[model samples]
Target: MSAAPELRRNSLDLPEAVEAARAQYAARRPRSAALHAGALEVLAGGNTRTVIAYEPFPAAMVRGEDCRLWDLDDHAYLDLCGEYTAGLFGHSEPRIHDALHAVLRRGINFASVGPGEEKLARLICGRFPSIERVRFTNSGTEANLMALTAARAFTGRAKIMAFRGGYHGGVLTFPITGASLATLPLPFVMADYNDNDSAAAVARANAADLAVILVEPMQGSGGCIPARPDFLATLRALADETGAVLIFDEVMTSRHSAGGVQARLGITPDMTTLGKYIAGGMSFGAFGGRADIMALFGGKLPHAGTFNNNVLSMAAGGVAMGEIFTAEVAEALYQRGEALRARLNAVGAAAGVPLSFTGIGSMLTAQFRIPAPDRPYVPTPGEEQLRELFFFDMLEAGIYLARRGMVALSLPVADADLDRFVAAVADFAENRAELLRADGVTG
Candidate 1:
């Protein structure tokens, strides 16, 4: 409208463009700015969740309905974040709301066991093929912790083979370049994802003491990198040969289908960990597998949590699994997600830019790297700057996605909203292709 502000790497500078975007963002959300300032006086860095903490502070959302959200500044946005895949039913899924409300009427904590837990357990066992005997947790992080603990106890071994780019939970993260400092103090043998040889070598080296081979069918926090089917098969074989348990962390990827990516690939692991959308947006997590392994929890291995099977989570999870997320619904959602990702990638390709979206079924990450990362965490030089700029641009366009360029589609997001997101990407490509390709070489 006003000649596009004329910012460039060799001229005005890419940082100049970012500054301009930040200025616009700040101007539009004065109220949110004050709120953040106030939060800074209390919360560390003005945030509770690390992922949501970004530069210039994140928006405080006030309300949401269906696939839309209203920020504190009263700016309406199409919610593309979907609460990091935990909000699959969207802001106001009547079914989930009703279930929670009904649970409240039945009563709060009985200080013992409840009937809803059994219903939820049955639904989870029925849907997920690898889960024969399941146990609940307050979060996916807990689920993975217990799963790994079980493996160690069952095998009488301590070593675990975890992928470099894999993330089981907050305390169990393995980054591509190096390991996270917050990672649990456990004997971890890290291998590269999507590399059979790397995994094989590690598994063999730790064979004697290897307790489990933990992986994600599709890496979520690791930029949505999908593992090659053969790589998974190799892990399965290696686990069997080494007498190690194979655990699939489907906390996020379980949204791929009713039975998760495991069912789609026809490869069953010894154990499975699940969370995110499983409880219909309520806080929930579960870990289960061979009866012999889970049976330990009931006997020797003690699994204790104040709200492991809370009424709200149990009821909501049961309704979500049994009614809302039926097999047919899963199949349809999967198809829509596949089609949406294809269209988004096509827009990037057509723009002749290096940007691409990588993921499976309703989950995706917009990245600047091409050919999609196979293993090593070494990122493309200018990949991050491009995505940071894209994040600001999309936010300005009223599309609420993760600052890290994550997009998790909800069931309520309409086809028209999809078109709008694609259009926004197209505009970003056209407007920033030169700066993106120049790799920010400043004058």
Candidate 2:
């Protein structure tokens, strides 16, 4: 019952590692320090996204091209974070850049349908048979809003069922019940992910009021847990039995396959929401499903946004999707992702870190296990310390992955980039874990 062996490498010593990482960051961004000081004067958290803010301060990135990003102080690093999987086509990809530039010249928001909308919509529907019609939005959050509205309209019910740890964009009503969104309530009921029986039981119990069951085919924010196929099939059956809309939020998983997780699984949901890679990093989202369900927006339910299908996003999304999504391209991404996952597993095993990964194609997550059952899987008092150490270590090592340990591979990422990432993991295993142990985070 003594403290278990250290899980990571010597690089993760809590107190020492945090200080070292901050020192390294300060060394690289003298300008960023000044910028943060100035930003804090105006910005509430000195940053827009709360998650991106970290101790000391977050570096302000000035430019990004392809797989690399540069800070205000001119520090360049490989961008493995990809804006949290939104940049699947890479930063400022040529096709997207060109399309965006051209479209911007014409206009940005017309608040009217443009030619690009029809083209992009056609592409989205063509890939996923379940998406017979679609409505565009500016971000994933808006897409979920529309999807939920449609579900409520179609089912004539009030409650939505979401899997625990499943993320369907930030809807205050839906509140992220599982991993992060454990606060809010849509008259929501949480069921264990990858556990179909529990989920089915919840649906049965809540059948009368369940409007829809929203899930991520692969949970990106919730530790990148893959939704078990059987669980999805069972959920589909339950939804059908209870007359609830089955909505799969494929924002993170769309890059994996043309039609997304629904298409990859060869199962159709009554509705689907897509974002992230859809616009090739410029910011776009869409919700589509059966024609009748989607058509609810036309008159029955209201779904309107002046910038929903802005010309630039549509143009960039159309060009990027057309170029990147093909049988050959998808297969190549699959193979590359498998290689990356295998390398990470090897690193974890050697480091004595119980790391597990689940996903298909380019999207994946690395879950670091803690000895405490409620540690990694459920948030414990010390969980924040462990996560902070892991991220600080990884960031110091020059691999810019999320603190939560999610990785999104771009089609542009080649052998060298992949090798660099794997090597970083190995270094962490060999050097970072000791740092974590020294911080009193052992086991």
Candidate 3:
């Protein structure tokens, strides 16, 4: 199906819009500004995650519940960022909170496996057909590291291939340098996302040394782009041809479905790395795949971590996956996401804006394009300019859009909230032409 119809472009004034956004934000978040100034003395840029850092100051979060968050400055927002897509059940969910209390009271950690670990593991394997056995880690990054290590051990190969835009999170350890980042280790060979020929060429060239091919079913950090059906099938074929293990890093995309993008796409990886929503807004991660490959860690390879299956994380995750997140809930998210996409496209069409929106299940992104009548190309920086403009303007309109073009939809984001989000996008579409003009990107 096509996106909504197009709209006419509005004349914009660049400098004025930038100044307006700056002044408006500075006034609304005075507490954050003051805190940022004080924090600069001790912490670099007064924040933690680089992604959260923005122009002026970062909005420090004070508290969160369900889908709403209150920033340090006492400003409340409908949290679309969702802790960078980690708080899947929304923040401080009741099911997980209650489970945590019970688990913590019983004990925090034991050197041996907890029964809750098996329950969570079973939940994961039951959802995804490929994962015969699973192992827990503390984060997605660690889970990926484990997957890569296990893949190499099983195949007896040294090199690994990953996609250019795909992120598997341990480039430094594998010496897999990211195309977008300057970090090192630098051993990974890159393939383009959604391109079958490009992936085939990489597989052919590295056929001998390649131990694994790690990919994200949908590239989250690269921009919420889904892998084409042909691309996934091609990779799986290549893995079979080259005798390389195929791994899907489903950290961000796991919330989209019970089995994640792999199942939704109807492709299975040999191994999978999962995190984010698994712990119900807490820190946790796990990786699993074919039983033969995953069992290497127990006696064949030997890997250990102090908190691999920490009792509390296991307990909370078991409850979240077992009871809180249901097939009905996931389907609800997909429906809501579809509505949001349609609304955004409609506004873009009415405004003559090249509003191209695409997403699978619950994840979505809308990119603005220049004034081409049909099939308009995304603006030179793709949609970055519009993303920045919308980010600032939406905040003024009282919406908390992440600096990125994405908004993670939580279960609590109801009809009213969706209305507000759609209205904000329309406001941006009407005003962005002017905002860009003011910023000096004139025709």
Candidate 4:
């Protein structure tokens, strides 16, 4: 009858511990601090990418080799962030590195259809189940934009259905805080993720005006939460009934399998947008689907980008898909990730830490939350403090995690490294027991 300890609204009283960690972090990275100070003169808030920035200044990584990174302060860390899931092949993948060199020797930008484009396109079309025909783009943001455009053109509808906490790209974010002003100016009906009835109701309400229902098979930026099979099935059925385009934004989840999450889930969307490691760690993006819808792009609605088919991305992407990340290797990597996640969860259970990791395959995000038997998972208030404390603690232990507590595995990460990371988490739970326990976190 009493309030659940984990659900009580108590202030996270860890200022002293947090300050100590911050002090240690600052003392270890004076050079990085100075770099950020100087960068403030030019770059906005000493940051070009918003996600990489953190308080007490972000560590300036000097170089990376395989699964390791060294900061300007000479601190070495196992690169668990994996460039936020984009560094799947790791920093120094030999094949992709050599392929980029070959591309440079041949030409930087031919400004015309290059030989590698077809090769890369062929590989993508073959690997992704939904991509019957594909087109290149400079980034995933552009790819999503193009896919939505194609949908609106084909369906002649102006509205889009997106989920709260879903991040398609910089301009396509739909956080629980609400869509930002920078988000593309379109009529977007927001729905809760993994809530089938909410999604179905939203789709029904907008069935007449819905152009596309855009979703991530696993919501990457929304804490790596995988969609329930029934939820995806509901969307598929809704799209079928309404004749709206269903687009899966697999920019991060595509690395889950050779055929991506769509193939694994036994669901095929009308379109798929891809990026991240598909280009072998190079900058790249792609969108493709039923040939009938895509045919409208060049003929009915003009689509062009100067670097759409750049030689470097095309060549590296081709080698990445065809030579390195074959179906067999992808399956093996996925199995490794599944095992690692299980181990991590086991460690959390043993330590009595209220830690939950949500993800599939090589992608994951750690969250601090109270378990609810009758409701969906919702993060606890002041959980960010726990996350930041964990981040600094993990860094001190020589594991580089995202500030937001995301950890992604790369092909080059060894089993020993994963074991070490798990050990580090256990150590964190022990060391921060008082603070965590006071916050009502329990196994």
Q: Pick the candidate with the highest TM-score.
A: 1
Query: How much lDDT does candidate 4 score?
Result: 0.85
- The number of the candidate with the highest lDDT is 1
Candidate 4 lDDT over residue span 1-443, tens digit each: 11122222233357656667788789879999999999999998899999999999999999999999999999899999998888999999888889999888877967788779999999999988899899999899999999999999999999899998889999999877765877988889988888888988999998899999999988887788888888899999989988899999999999888999899999999999999888998889999999999999768989889999988898899899999999999998889988887887777667776766778888887766534111224455557778888888888889998998888899999989988988888877666666666664444
Structural similarity to truth (TM-score) of each candidate: 0.96, 0.90, 0.90, 0.95
- Poorest stretch of ten by lDDT in candidate 3: 1-10
lDDT of each residue in 378-424, candidate 2, tens digit only: 54434456566566666666667776767788767889988887777
Clashes of each: 0, 21, 17, 1
**221-311 in candidate 3: lDDT tens per residue?**
6556777778888999999999999999889888777788777778988999999878787788899999999778778887789988888
| Between candidates 1 and 3, the lDDT winner | 1
> Which model is ahead, 2 or 3, in terms of lDDT?
3
lDDT for predicted candidate 1 compared with the true structure: 0.87
lDDT of 2 at 80: 81
- Candidate 1 ranges beyond 4 A from true positions: 1-11, 440-443
| lDDT at residue 54 of model 1 (Cα atoms) | 77
| Model 1 agreement with the true structure over 1-443: per-residue lDDT tens digits | 11134432335456777777777778779999999999999998788899998778688899999999999999999999999999999999998999999889989787788888999999989988888999999999999999999999999999989988788889999888887999998999988889888999999998999999999998888888888899999999999999999999999989888899899899999999999998999999999999988889888899999999889999899899989988888888889988988998898788877777888889999877565555536564466667778888888888999888999999998899999999988888778888766653221
